[model samples]
Target: MKKKLAATAIGAAMVLSMGTGVLAGANLQEIKAYLNGSITVKYNGSPVQLQDEQGAVVLPITYDGNTYLPVRSIAKTLNVAVNYDGATNTVLLGEQAEGVALAKDFKNSSYHTKDPNLTTYGGKDYKEVYFDNAKSSRSSSFMLYPKGKYQKLVLQVAATGNDIESFYVQDSKKDIKLKTTTIAIQDGLKTIEVDIAGVEELFVHADIKEDGGMFVPLTTSYFK
Candidate 1:
């Protein structure tokens, strides 16, 4: 009978980022560890394949009587986001870390209009704005790919005229609506946050009154 080493997933919920380093002046203990290539990982009855950021297979390591696996790979498999603060040598799990600016990461494009215009309001310039023609009640949408790296989407929205109707957040890959809300132009600017856990692709949709107006959704921040 071959003795197989089993690795216990320690701190799988708190994963270390690829760039985070160990604490300073930490004592290092050297031990003889074995690399186990023939290990299977499973979740709920489903098998989980472990791979690095580059899609390379990562093996489990067995030291003494315990087995260890890569933290980032395990976190991703569990549908959790991992962030590291290099300045403080901290590992943040889920949405505990700071938010990421969406504009720097996501691509902007028009969904219904022939051309989307960039507008400014309250002394702040917005790059993604929805322009509606008064021909009919219409909607515009844009997409962002989170790939399970973010947990929430935070933004503020407002309409120039009385054409504000509704806002929706949908899981584009699953074709499911996660959240939706109606907006009133009299409310001025409205702030909203949507849960986006484990979502591969997300769609933000805005419904207008077709009264020839402008709708602006600002602040592209996401929690990781």
Candidate 2:
């Protein structure tokens, strides 16, 4: 992945008058409830929702007749990365990769066999998610949905003791397939990178040996 430059945002501001006298031990920060105000944010034509700890709007505060909204909250709703420099009292905002967070992955009913212990199927004790074809030539698939813009579906897959002959994303029309030089893991899943751009609905399908194929899972995320 290529790195992008980060943006910076300020949270709050304080100003004092020349005539004001300050005491060395006196505190200056104060908090008060604000009402009768409106604030809205949007991203990609979609409303960016912002909420407070109590699930209420993190309203803009009026201090010294100036209104301000929490910068961190606004950045988060837009999926922007944020970092704070306490020494310099700075807030750094950068490009953060928002991935396709899996809520639920639906699997097909046609699997050759099922095993809880992945070590039996392969060699690793890692958890097994889905298998394409281990006893038959049939194709098994899993349907998934991811939002926002992405270039491909990232998968960590391994088959038997050797790499599978064919593996592809079956939900889209484009010829998306796994391209990797790493051989199949004898015990764990290997990262398989493939192009799956412009795909909102994902169908990941794979075909391994009819007699000795049980794909194991490591981790799955989106890549752009």
Candidate 3:
């Protein structure tokens, strides 16, 4: 992914400030509550429905007893511009404003698949996997282990184009089949929670329907 020099610099500065008392620490629930009351979100100055008035937003469940707000909503509320690169599935949210408080409890961690060939499926390549677009492509299958029981299954799906469609837990030995789904190419990042029973080795497969091609990226720390 090409770096936006300006955004990169800003993000770097924010990261540094995280430890220097610039950013506060809090839990996911606390951050959600704060966001509920503190900011109103507008996409391109138009109100967007990412959360509710009572702060009862349906967020992706994570392992650490935290919740992830949609990146788009947070960026808009914080007055940062967001961009996504379809070819790479790379999302860039412009820098946060000075003195703006970010969710103190949420830790930014990288979770990715290692198989280079795993990106493309059904004659199409999704440059990166996102929590928002997980329901695309019925042929795609990914695994999520909860903090411990049985790992959950996040299959590439096609429910409603707007919602996170379907998610559930499954035994390791079960053979799972995914439904087909597709998403329009867009620039932005989406977060999702994968329930891993425990900290165990998890595998996700991105198999392109055409020619039965498969590419797998190395699994990193997935949330929930």
Candidates in order have lDDT scores of 0.62, 0.47, 0.32
Q: Candidates sorted by lDDT, descending order?
A: 1, 2, 3
Model 3 residue 224 distance off true place after TM-score fit, in angstroms: 4.7
The lowest-lDDT stretch of 10 consecutive residues in candidate 1 is 11-20
Q: Write the per-residue lDDT of candidate 2 for residues 96-197, one digit (tens) a residue.
A: 244442323434455422456532343444343555445655444566553223455567666763456555654444444434343354535666565543
lDDT by residue for model 3 (1-224), tens: 32221210112111100222322432214422222222333344454455322345533223233333555435434434444433444454442122111121222223243233544444555554322123234444454432222233223322222322233323344443222223222311222233332223343433233222222212222221
Q: By TM-score, how accurate is candidate 2?
A: 0.41
Deviation in Å, model 1, residue 216 alpha carbon: 3.3
- TM for every model, in the order presented, reads 0.65, 0.41, 0.20
lDDT of 3 at 212: 26
Error of 2 at 43 (Å): 19
Alpha-carbon deviation at 194 in model 2, angstroms: 3.5
RMSD (Å) of each candidate, 1 decimal: 6.8, 11.4, 17.6
Give the Å error, residue 62, model 1.
1.3
Name the top lDDT candidate.
1
Instruction: Show pairs that collide, candidate 1.
Output: 7-67
Model 3 worst lDDT window (10 residues): 8-17
